[model samples]
Target: MAPGITTVLDVRTPAARRQLAKTTVDLFRNLLLLLFIVRYSRVALTYLYGYGPIASAKMGYAALRKSLYRIFLSLPGVRGKVQAEIKQTLEELEKKLVPSGPGITRYTALPASGWGPEQVRAELEKLHEMKHTRWEDGRVSGAVYHGGKELQDLQMEAFGRFGVANPIHPDVFPGVRKMEAEVVAMVLGMFNAPADAAGVSTSGGSESIIMAVLSAREKARIERRVTKPEIILPETAHTAFRKAAAYFKITVHYVPCPGPTYKASLSHVSRLINSNTILLVGSAPNFPHGIIDDIPGLSRLALRRNIPLHVDCCLGSFLVPFLERAGYDTEPFDFRVKGVTSISCDTHKYGFAPKGNSTLLYRSAALRKYQYFISPDWSGGVYASPGIAGSRPGALIAGCWASMMSVGEAGYITSCHQIVGAAKKMAEGLRSRDTLRNDLRILGKPLVSVVAFTSDTLDIYNIADAMSGKGWHLNALQSPAAIHVAVTLPIVPVVDELLNDLEACVEEEREKQRQAVVEGKPKAKKGDAAALYGVAGALPDKTIVEDLAAGFLDCLYKA
Candidate 1:
């Protein structure tokens, strides 16, 4: 044989080689196309099933309509009118909010000359004397959970002790570190989390929720290779979850909490589950109606699909955990449920702690590790921080710890008894009174401290305004046009007063409706609540509402 002869066994002829090369190229090209289809198909499927097949189309249409409406309203005359209305509303808000009269002065900035300590103290006392909602008189809802003199003193003392301490430097503040740990441990114990369960402290319920969502998304990405994460929650779930979705780039599937029980629909949640689902959410006595969700149902569903479940007990907080102890019947909402993976509870609410305190608990340390941010290669000595903050207020943590310890378990049970007892009484008044029941319909069977009611026959917002007129503050909700009052220890003594005010407000609204009917005209009365909600609810567009909200925040910063 020749030195470089080509044979049949060594290689095919040049024509055969050309044919093989074309076949290989064609095979590679087809593989890439198939990969593209597979990747995009998963994304399409995630959204399609996350929202119902028809819901996706409807949402798309609504979004388009809203966008068009926004553009239309942005025209010169229209925009000017809208801005003028917002400005007027803000002016009215400022008048209602800030102190007034000849002696009152707003300290918009520091005095040009530094004041002596006594001068500062005198100035503070004058500001405190200014007109404000008398929360101490028990007319306000949800804001001041427990305002007892002793508890307030204890929190103030705790804050004084740790005012300068920062948890970011735990070594520098050992006592704060211990207190924060104890606070989390006690909360976890209350939830009946397993031995391996763990948690981290947060500034508030919103941060707790955000951390839980972040952990779920990260876990799904690392473990299951999911790119587009999705979460399913009840319609009654807190707005905080929606904020979390916006922050984390997660798609949200809202299951309607229909009439009657107003609980999360298990069937809807089941239908929405997909391979990309990062989390499932259930509220323990939701903020709107104060009705606890069917947690056992959601837990079973999550177990079947192997998805993480988060229970938001921010409003329920300290009270829901002690419901049975407080001699009230309860349902499964804590870590006892088999598939429950995480829970976010606010120490600021029913826990009676300082304002900036909450906890996010996880089923295990492994899951919680996902929430930790580590920078092993950082120039500044390898930075690592837990939760969403670098330097957190140790004073708040100390205050929270003091509140929880000072109250103890027995104290919490007693407070829950008073608060829940007051709430149930209010609900009973709405349900039993013939005229009141006929005029107002309770949204759900509230078993916790909140009671929400709607009126299909009259303007509930007007009733809310009337309550405000009587110096009673209530929360306004839309989608069904309702209002709610979250009972606190401060309100426990004034339950009867609340009932009386509610009855009067309802009658007032009913009379207005009746007069409008007799005159053959639509009932039109305006108040801050009425105007804000009525306009927002009537329009398909949210641009005006968004603008007003932004403007409100801006107003808070002005002098």
Candidate 2:
């Protein structure tokens, strides 16, 4: 043997050997554990934090799921059965909504001779009488904001005076231009915008949002040389932003909102920012939850990053700015936030203007100029338009101006107080219920006039369908299935009735679900609402959803 060789292996006590064996095993196990983790880290990271190449893999899985569903639905028997069921359901719904008559007589081809104004007006009145849902009673949420007869009369009068006028011919219709400018000026004053701040009226909220996005995109491209512009928005931000992204060919990154509050996670937002980030968006009060983002924090981020910040106050409109003066607690989400570059507000929603009017406001004239579409080399001379539309209806602008003047600041404050107070009462009543208190939870701390509720135990969509049966038209939300009521002046008078109805509906749904479980009936897997949302929320291939949405839109025009 060699001189340094030892006899056998070094011996140790029993406890020491056991410890050595354990350590050896642990060392081997740890190596294996690390290998396993390294292998699955991509998946875990994607599932938990939505990061890395695994994100693409998850998207592929989603696409596969959607494709499988589509393929399954395309089987002969499956397609026929599903189509028949859909047809029956749609027929039932149409029967309930449409009046008893030959269904909507379409004038496929215009008459050789035009009907006179009186005849046309008479036909329009007849068409209006055939609708079932009386939105004027405020049965619908966020549809008809102000239904007072006085406002209607004022709008009609204003329309009659300016129906023939067009803002395009400024010299001939100087009054129209003046009124438009004044409307923009008045809205700017309402938000306390700086002297350099400017804006233009658009057809509605979507157009306003699109114009703002366009401005941000162009500004980033020209100023910062950002080629692949990306806009960061809260998940609760309006779907309009997605539409803008698609239309403008910009990238959109959604940041999730935190717990019970449903406000954007500023920490995650800070992490998401890259060199290509052109704009950061915060909603004053988002449509789904009616919760304002942490605008102060988002503004600070924008300031530090030197990115444009756009606040969507479309749904908030007249309510948010006036909440503080109306004796309700509110947050700072307006021009007061130094980094805010633009805002979109709908005059039609809470401003009580006629439908088809909204404002796109910018922090400065330099920013506003980016949104203008100008064609210098056009054959039809140098052409420029302030917003998306070339020839907009002056009648709507006139009506908007009239509505604003009629509902002065004091009137809005009073309306805000009533609506906000009623919404709070309804929320309180829901919270007080022992049955719903635990299972059902409000999405956020709503300071304005909207309240959204979801449930952990029961299907909230089923509750929504039940509420629909009771003639309460509440909005259905997804991601996590929930429903919301946008309280209006009319809802103020019937707040108790609404809460009572909601309680009854929830209880009835719970009973139905319990009976279904006891009888072993499949518990109504997921009704039409859930099925429709399932397809929408699941599909990574948005084109498939787009096709479905297009089909649905086409159905809206069915003869």
On lDDT, the candidate that comes out on top is 1
What overall lDDT goes with each candidate model? Answer: 0.90, 0.84
lDDT of 1 by residue, 181-294 (tens): 999999999999999999999999999999999999999999999898989989999998999999989988889898888999898899889887999999998888899999
Clashes of 1: 0
Positional deviation of residue 544's Cα in model 1 after best superposition, in angstroms: 0.4
Using alpha carbons, what is the TM-score of model 2? 0.85
Alpha-carbon deviation at 222 in model 1, angstroms? 1.6
Clashing pairs in 2: none
- Quote the lDDT for 391 in model 1: 90
For TM-score, the strongest prediction is 1
Question: Residue 200's C-alpha lDDT in candidate 1?
Answer: 95
Q: Give the TM-scores of the predictions, in the order they appear.
A: 0.90, 0.85
lDDT of 1 at 193: 96
